[model samples]
Target chain A: MKIKTLNLALAASMAWGTAASAQTEIEWWHAFTGRLGELLAAQVEKFNESQSDYRVVASHKGNYSEALNAGIAAFRAGEQPHLLQVFEVGTATMMSATGAVKPVYEVMEESGLEFDPEAYIPAVTGYYTNSDGQMLSFPYNSSTQVLYVNRDKLEEAGIDPDVDLSIWENWDEVLTQLKDAGVTCPYTTSWQSWVHLESFSAYHDVPFATNANGFEGLDTELVFNGDIQVKHIDQLGEWAQEGKFIYNGRRNEAGANFRAGDCALFTESSAGYAGVKAEADFDFDIRHLPYWDAVDAAPQNTIIGGASVWIMEGHTDEEYTAVAAFLNFLSSPEVQAQWHQDTGYLPITNAAGKLTEEQGFYDENPGTEIAGLQMTRNEPTDNSKGLRLGGFDQIRTIIDEELEGVWSGQKSAQVALDSAVERGNQLLRRFEQANR
Target chain B: MEKRVIFKGWMLPALLLMPQIVITAIFFFYPAGQAIWQSMFVPDPFGLKTQFVGLGNFEYLLNDPYYRASFLTTAIFSTLVTVVSMGVALYLAILADRLIKGSGTYRTLLIWPYAVAPAVAGVLWMFMFNTRVGVVSWYLGLLGYDWNHVLNEAEAMGLVVAASSWGRISYNFLFFLAGLQAIPRSVIEAAAIDGAKFWTRFRTIVWPLLSPVTFFLMVVNVVYAFFETFGVIHTITSGGPQQATTILVYKVYSDGFVGQDLGSSAAQSVILLFVVGVLTVIQFKFIERRVHY
Candidate 1:
């Protein structure tokens, strides 16, 4: 009996020792937490289970900024992960990383995976593509701004629940209706500088910056202080002063207010769907963002939000091949469709969209298709594509500060915008000089 | 033979200190040296390409209005927070010292704020001061004031400084309390027999004896005020209401990570290191001399 027990113990020890050394771990650093984090973990687990070749390990470094910083620091230490998720604002910075990254298209091609760049939605793919229309990063979770309406709140305010807050021909009509309905918090938005200034410019088919919003080159200049921007901000400021439009604190604190049904209308990213679905007890609908009637081409496609998975350099070829396989797995029609349905992010591939439509997701979940419709309805011009400016996050901060001044009645819209332009231009010049 | 024996003993002690010295050399001294080296040159994002610019980055920073503004703001923020925190902490320590009962409980309760991490501290203060749903805003509304830090410059500064000091005062209090307790009861008794009141007793014996602790706390508070409040400022205001709350460390983070101007950010970091170094040297030279210890 003692000999049998010793034999069993020896067998267990040998099994444990070999199991510890078996898995070839691939580090996937991302900027997701909460519900998104869970979904991401499930995806990693599914991928890990599907294959025995490599184990993909996902770590939440921090928010977008912190994750990017961690990736950069790790890269400098020669310890970068196989895959790093970078937000849209870091596109230009990532592009300028000379040899710190291996382009996704190149990786896919080198790995001999049956890859097609055209398989991705043009608008979604273009943001992370090179000038020649080659994808540089995998579009992991792409979202665009949409108007979220509290149907219950609207009905309570004696406004028609079916009223087309979806298509505001002009700001004048939006203000009139909101005032008539006595909406104390008619409209509030998260990422004001994003939805209002950057995406707003893109949606209006207006230039936000010179040099095709910095896509053409690094020497981009701030032009968001143009007439259209000034007029919109001034109108919003007026609404703010009248209590029709509430300016929540910077960041997404307004998300809670909207989810809690305090606000009648919210301008936020489509990825906010998960939070709204979970938190909102009242009926709500997502709609296309409202546009100004005066613009010749209103509702020109909105720019992408969320983030992309950039493959950092310095990993071995085996790691790259593993990354390519993981990305391809992520981009498969079934996986892409499920990811889009699970998170409010857009389907990156055409097949995923068709799959979603076939699944009756759009029909069952109204307004889920609005983002795709808005993005596809208009062919992207230079102004509508996206901004790729260096120091853009800092520039956004500057815009936020200046716009807050206008919102608080401290500075006029024109003055605030002009100061923002001047200050933002200085940052551009510094960026240009540094990168030169 | 005695000298040789002493030298042999010192050799072992030096050997014992080698690991720490090696770590400091590898981590701290090496990176600091590299930062200084990089500040003189322009390095690419990957840190591969380098071109010697020789003070070009410094010259640019000097000429740049935003950088200058950030520096001035940092100085003002550091000085104000340090002075205010030290004053408040000293007062609290004195009050706690005078209490004959439950002094330990008071001390423990006072130091509790320091136990919270900076990130949580930032979020907690942000929750309290946020305009839309903040409890403080509710109170302000009751008082008939439209209190929104996001739009008001003064309010933004006040909110950041208050949050920073609130988190920082506990450590200062702990130091001050310890210093207060260490004072001999005989001195206070002597002052009492001589008809000295509480204020007079504090002004003479207690104040001089606590000077060492006060000086140490001042240096610590200055450093904390300068570098440690970045998380609070980042969460609360993000240096908003037109860059009113942007201090040095926050600027470094913005310029380095968010802004992606690694060279400029490194340059700013070097300048901060220099500023902190100067302040530290002056504190040691001037204030340390006045310390009773």
Candidate 2:
């Protein structure tokens, strides 16, 4: 009886060993949870099913910031996965990690895959590419800032559903109208610095920082306290004081109020479409991010906000090949179109946009095309391409503090912006010194 | 007069002390030493290269206004958390002790919150005070109070202190209750027979007897507020509404993990270690003085 049991255990062990060794495993750590995580898992399942030689295993490693930390810690422990998903703000940090990352261009070239850099949207890929015009990471999910309007709330507030919110002057009038109509929170914004400041600078074709928004060199100084930027922030501060604008917690905490149909207008990432569409019972419309008419030819373009997948170092060449194949599968037109349509993230590739258009997916979803159009509206200027500043996340926190000062009525817009610039410059100097 | 059981041979003593020494070296001293070593060097985010900055990181921290502000924030936050939590816990412990019939039931109910994670407790309090949907905020709004912590620094600090204290009250309650129950019944009865009022008995007898427990809990609660309440601050405000609640530990995390400034973060940790050390020393001195009484 003992011999029989031992033989059965040995047979089971042999079977498991063969099954596991039959396919090479690719570990992918991502920040996405909820519906996005489900979609990522589904995509990985399809990839694994399509190719029996390689199995891609995807893991949710907390939020964007936490996932980036996990990757760094894992790399230090020499146990990093084959791929890591990092938010856009960490682009500079990832690029500066010299030997810690394997650029996507190198991965594709080494895998002998027919890779075309032009297949992706310039604006989407531009944010993740190096100065040499080489792609550093796969633009997995990119979102541009856009305005969300509750049409029902607008009608109730005695305002036109089609009221032009394209320019700040019109937006100001609308906000006042809503306030006069007794709306408590007529306007609130998510990602204040991103939508109001970063995208604001880019849309007005103004430099947020010197050195072409930190792309030219690391010795960049914050120039976001520019006249136009100050003018816009000053208006928001005035509105805040007047109770027309509600100050929500930093990030998308205000999205809840807007989705609850309490706030009439929300300036948030276009990706908020997924949540707003699901939760909001009111009829809503997506519009271009409001611009300052004071600038020459207003609304240049809004920069990206979501994350991209970067290939980490210390993975075997075999694993790199697997990662490249997985990336290719992800970027396929059909898959990209489906992902874009499902998640409201802008399609990374022009082919996916065209495919979605040809399939009438955008036609069915009227507001979905706005994000893509907003990103590709014009040839991106040096200022509008994207920010690539080391220690950008820290700078954003500093910006949040100063902006909070304005909202809390503690300081004027100019004072807050000036402080933000001075503090942000110090961090920039520190980052430069550390890296050098 | 101290009880002594000195081992006759050095070999046996070393063997007996081996486990504790190993644990301290591995769990405490080693990582702390690493942090101290790393504090003197700045590494690029990729960890490919590092430069010896000597005391550069510490000097920068001392000069950085935000870092200094965080130190003050930590001081205010820990004090508020320790006092509020211990005060409430002691009050509840006394009430539970007075309830002779179902004291165990009340004790169990009060202790349940300690089982909750600090982050979860933060979320729970956050939900109750959330500007849009929070019951407390909505009620306050109806009363024309306009409870908006997102923009209100005082309210933000209040919310974090409440959340941090709420979780710790359960822990403090357990200790206070144990101390209360450990008191001799005859002594309290004799005080009652002497016509001493409840407040007077508690003040003169129960309070002095509870001092040791109180002192121990103060140290534990201070450390808890300093280190363990990071989750509470992170979840409730992300240390914001203008860094009103950006405590020292949260800054260490934000700078180290989120900002990826390892050298600065390590330096912050080293300074924090020094602060904790000084606090512990002061606490021990106070405890020694109280012990003589």
Q: Is the docking of candidate 2 incorrect, acceptable, medium or high quality?
A: medium
Candidate number achieving the greatest TM-score relative to the actual structure: 2
At residue B90, what lDDT does model 2 achieve? 96
Best by lDDT: 2
The true-versus-predicted C-alpha distance at residue A35 of model 2, in Å, is 0.5
Supply candidate 1's per-residue lDDT for A152: 88
Clashing pairs in 1: none
What is the DockQ of the complex in model 1? 0.49
C-alpha root-mean-square deviation, each candidate: 5.4, 3.5
Cα-based lDDT at residue B222, candidate 1: 90
Evaluate all candidate structures by whole-model CA lDDT and list the values in order.
0.85, 0.91
lDDT of 2 by residue, A91-181 (tens): 9888888888999999999999778998999999999887788999999999999999999888998898998888888777888889999
lDDT of 1 by residue, B133-187 (tens): 7899889899998887877788888888888888688989989888988999998
Ten residues in sequence with the least summed lDDT for candidate 1 chain B = B1-10
